[model samples]
Target: MICFNIIQLFVILKLCSGMRYIDLKSNFISDGVEVQHGYFMTSGKYKMFHARDPALEVIQFGETRVFPDVDYTPGTHSLFVEQFKVGDEEALSIYVFRMSVTSNSVVYKVYFHMSEFGYKLIDCAKFTELIKGKIHVSLDLSKSKSHPFFNIHTKEEHGQSTTLIEIRKSIAGFRLRNVEAKRYEFGRIMDSSFPIYMGYSKLNMFLTKATSIFIHKEDNRKYIVLRHWTKNIRFDLMTVNGILAWNAITDPEPSLLEDMHQKVFRLRDRIDGYRALNPLSTLDLAENISPELLGIEKVTGRHGGSTYALYHLEIGKEAYNKIKFVVNSEMLDMLIAKIDDRTLYAKVEVITNSQRTFLIITCLMKIDLVYETVINYYDKPNMENTSYYHVPEPYQTKIVSDMYKKYPVLINMDIDNPPSIVDHGELQYDSYILKYFRIKQEDGRGSVLSGKYAFGDIWQKDLHEIGNIPYEGNKRRLKVIAHSVNSSRIIVKPKNMEYPLLPEELQDYVIIDG
Candidate 1:
């Protein structure tokens, strides 16, 4: 009991004496690398310490040190420190700590810091994770483009990157996951999902891509008002003009901040609501958390009379069909004009709000697009047994010999080397398409008459519909005329050099691009 009292007294005095400064963790005396506490800089002071050693207190995430000296106000401070150990070189380090307090302890969290000239490669990480193990060694490949053991070459072709890794498994020094979430920003993006999220409890604002910082006089605190469009009214990171970072408390707006919190939780409620929904049986499941999304295409359209994105998302196993994604924030809707949606893998659930239901992406963790099957499908498919198209009917053998000359680009494809259309005949499955067909003949030189799917996505049969679709701001699209599936659906150009049929009403309309 007496020992406990002394320790308590010392802690109380440390807090009350206004000595709210932490001595930098000693280099050797501090706790060495342990998964949970490895990254936490140990607390201590040494005789070898320089005057600027106190600045190292800021090099933490989670709950920052309760240091009274290190200013959390906006602006960058450059500190140069000599080697922590004797006879070692110096380093330039600046670390940003995220704030989160647990049981009076400053929880060491994520970190992004600059080093002198080389990476401080540690074999172990500061946090616990099963997927990634840390790398112990450092490489000087930047100085000289050579590795003693491994040969790495990168090739870029047609907007795609391919890397050949021939290294032996004996190389335990190389990490399976080069980056982990608890240590940095990048690994999560590559291994997890995009729009990496981090929250700060010290202030009532979200900071990302900050622009300008403002310091208030009466409060003498750093305050940032961010404007975000990605979600939760994503506020663009607030930064100061000419200066990089600013941290201040929006102390005056307690009620306003509470209201904002209410709004944020409301979004969270919507997310939970989405997860409760039973996903489509047709869609591939994502470990039952949600339906998997194979890819994303951003569409600009009007929603509720206002401009927003109607995301055209690719569902599992189907490439041509699409599912729509709704936004969690109006701010994200506002950014519809600016967003450039990349082809990414995502998982989403359906939510019902305002008597309407839609799918929304709620992240657990996202993976990269799996395209091996797609690549192989193109290279290995037997075209004869698939849904294929070609020049339909009498146009298959007509005066259209000159059609190729008239529109070389339009008539291009494997026109002469046609594949026999698929005949399922009696095969049964979950689903199958009923399409028209004809057997291909290996007779003469390939010509525009021989049919194949390669020529183009749009055919002249769709010309009438395409020619009359309404312009922007109009929701109307083409409505194809009904026809029996047994009969082929193609129109001979000009009916022997004349015009094709159109809906009686649109006879006056003419296609502009055509």
Candidate 2:
């Protein structure tokens, strides 16, 4: 009995390692990890100090200020620790630490806040006096609907503020892939390697580590969004021994996955007035429609010249025409730039005001690649089918019968052997891609596996306009990002000299570090 208890404790300790500090950061939402902003730096707790361990002269501060250091340690793990010990008397430290990172470039946006007792201070006033108000400041700003900054805090920035972001070549980060107060407020995506390499063998290897596995179905393609709660999934790790014992504890087949996947994506409660848009009248809510941009032409009227964007949406044997009015040629240039080779399309809303009826580009429904690291993915299934659980897809739209095949459909296209974006447009670019990857050293560079595509080292980040004002394109939240930040400070840092098949249509992974 004694030996058994000791063994159990040992097992628990081993499992408890590698836990995350999830409670540190608030909701840092980014259209489902589609885009990432500049580095989030917090100097102080910015909250009510619950505990003050007198043993430590000062509290912890970093990306997650006052958050508990990982490993049950006391100090936060910033990318770099800045300090100045005046003399033999004592040490005064000022630091900026990044969130926890494993063996990969992706850093988890998580931190914990436990009482600090790591290092006791000899002179408390000296340390506290220099950095009291520096860490904590009153955020006078209101959480107004009109305010742009997601992080509403009032911590005063120090002189060395830019040193943290600028000193480093680049940094890759992820907030919780979540939605709050909106239609869906799920947890953060701990990892997207499952969706990144689902059909491949990657999902089988890393499924057990996922605390909650969700199947996100947009159109025909279903994406696996894996969420692992920090410290919660301790005992449920997928070690080598765990994998060996998987057969005894889990299902023997992929039936659960198949069943869950086959289940169609259903709509929950309608958030906006979209459902009540009166389908019988001039405006019909486009439930499940993919309209391709036919053409854009500039028309000169008696007053001035106006550009118009034409779209052809096929809805069950009938073609719904949509003409979008543009303000100027610059708008047309931006639209054409995004829709260069690939068919640029949007899900639109038709509106009429008794005089003229037109289409308001509602959204560009797009699924972009989010790069993540995975130990491996295999064919093992846990006992519970996670799909059957969670928020149910509430409302179901009536059948449109495949839009009665308006556009040409290539039925026999091979999804298994999808096109490889080695280089740009033509076949000659293959050599260029080969040259580029060889120079980058395919396996050595720590890029994501090339199973999905030839060179898979890319991520999709939503790049909105810099300030509070959102990206007001022809289509709202346009599915596009400039290669560089381009008059903005929100570019993703170097990705293992990273690569991401971005701008979905082009499959162009811009060169930053390499």
Candidate 3:
């Protein structure tokens, strides 16, 4: 009986596993004509073509309209037709064409032609190919009004020839061969209103639908506008929404000015903090100081024209601080040519102290003269000078260290391995305790110690074989010392190139030697 019960349990488990892997398909059909299996109607002036599916109830052909004939090739004439209901009644229809099937999926070429003008079915395959990949169509029905219309335009490359039309209407149901089908209900409405239809094909898998609303209000007037789009649809929805809401409020006075003032204050505070940290970094010097010295100057020429020169300078820390505080203040409004060289110049800014700003301005002044100590000789000479000033670094390092201390190091255990040394400190170590016998001490007193004290062979093998342990206790501790170190190891001693043994394979693996 026990054996039989076990067999029954095994069978039940197998069935459950099989059930989890099952794929079910639901079929839906609407009151429309299918266009896959060929069908024809002879009761009208134009024969209606449709598919053999029972879900598609009626098929009617729309009259073809063409523009004025022009002198063109015989086969180049654009020809297209729409299919609709016989009595001009509101009805939905889907046009499906079997192409090819592969693997477990069937491919069909679909086009959704609506009765509304300017509505044309977007070819899924062609659209996917244009996008360079397949994407599923996301359908959004929340903002749909009466039926959604998709406008599509197709044109051949390098040519002006094209065809445009409005086809199929009142698409209440649709289905793919050997796949699932969906049905939509369109309740009683005017002859102009019909159910919404969505076209899908194997090639176009990714699609999205979105909706938007716009509102405008002024004085006592209010306007609400709703807009929606699917991967197959397009239209602009709104310019603004809060405009109407603000107008509706009792107090409509603009408060944006006050908000702007508050934002400015906050921005100023942030800038002040940044400037405090980077005291020597200056934008004013880059804009005003350098440009003034490097401005164009006129030399000897038939036409007096300006010539500009580029100059650059790098200064040491001591000179950087002095220039920062003195040059800007003493020569704020001074002309470049009078102070130093006026031809070309540059300044190098560096951070020295949080409280002190620094700058090193170098200038190249040029003078153009046509003359000579001897007759029939001309010479032009240019002069350059470099200078800088800034606060000392002993003060800067102190402030930087204080700022670093403000943000303490936080150890993250979620990482595969913890940092070896956090904030310039080593992690605590635990000794491994062993349960075996112990050796006698020099003073003739013996105590419990690791098994390695007497059984070296067994202890060594156990240390290599045992996996990582949480902690070492007095009783079950191994004689070996296993340290829980962080991943980033800065080895200061024995730097000659020695690889440290990793803790264990299961715990962590080292990707780099550190």
Top-lDDT candidate index: 1
Query: Model 2: runs farther than 4 Å from truth?
Result: 1-309, 313-354, 358-514
TM-score of each: 0.16, 0.19, 0.16
Q: Which candidate leads in TM-score? A: 2
Runs off by more than 4 Å, candidate 1 = 1-189, 192-269, 274-294, 299-310, 314-514
Per-residue lDDT over 1-514 for candidate 3, one digit per residue giving the tens place of the 0 to 100 score: 4454643453354244321110001111122321111111212111122322221111212222111112322221111112222333222223432222322122233333334562244554432222221111122222232122222234444433232212122222323111221211111111111111111000010112123323333444433222222112221111121111111111112321233233333433443443322222222332322211122111110101112111222222212322221122123231121222232332322222323322323333344652211101111122123233232556556644643442221112211122111113232213321121112221111211222111111111121112221111111333312222223222221223344443553124222212
Q: lDDT tens digits, residues 79-100, model 2?
A: 2111222222222222223333
Candidate 2 Cα deviation (angstroms), residue 351: 8.3
lDDT of 3: 0.23
The TM-score between candidate 2 and the true structure equals 0.19
Scored by Cα lDDT, where does model 1 land? 0.25
| Model 3 vs. true fold: TM | 0.16
Clash totals in order: 21, 24, 40
The better-scoring model by TM-score among 1 and 2 is: 2
